[model samples]
Target: MSDIEFPDTLIALERAAWEELQAGRLTVATANAVQDAITQHAEAAGMSRVEVEMALKKAVRHAEG
Candidate 1:
């Protein structure tokens, strides 16, 4: 649903983080790791961190079945 090429590892991390957030188990380390991954992905893709993060979240949280 998105044009962004999200890395599987990044998606996994974000999914895990999302689950943690849902269960109130989110930690600083996990959140930071997701942010780091997003930053790296944005740099590698030559896109802004905001754009990459938005697309990634949509893909992860709002994907169609």
Candidate 2:
């Protein structure tokens, strides 16, 4: 489990962006939204961008449903 609690906005943007990526239809706007959200979340949470991103990926992809 991750110690960091990411915001729903960031998670949703990332999830949507990821789906676009898989479809090879990712737009610059979507990618930039995810990037911007990540940076904001990292700054707000006082964690490195990479740490937050990795934790987010694990949370989204590996979390048991």
TM-score to true structure, per model: 0.96, 0.87
Off by over 4 Å in 2: none
Clash count for each candidate, listed in order shown: 0, 0
Query: Which residue pairs of candidate 2 clash?
Result: none
Alpha-carbon shift of residue 61 in model 2 (angstroms):
2.5
Residue pairs with backbone atoms closer than 3 Å in model 1 (clashes): none
The digit string of per-residue lDDT tens for model 2 on 1-65 reads 68888778888998898889889999999999888899889998888999998888888767777
Could you give the C-alpha RMSD of every candidate to the true structure, in order shown? 0.6, 1.1
lDDT of 2 at 7: 79
Query: Residue 53 lDDT in model 2?
Result: 87
TM-score of candidate 2 on Cα atoms, chains taken together: 0.87
Using lDDT as the measure, which candidate wins? 1
Worst 10 residues of 1 by lDDT: 1-10
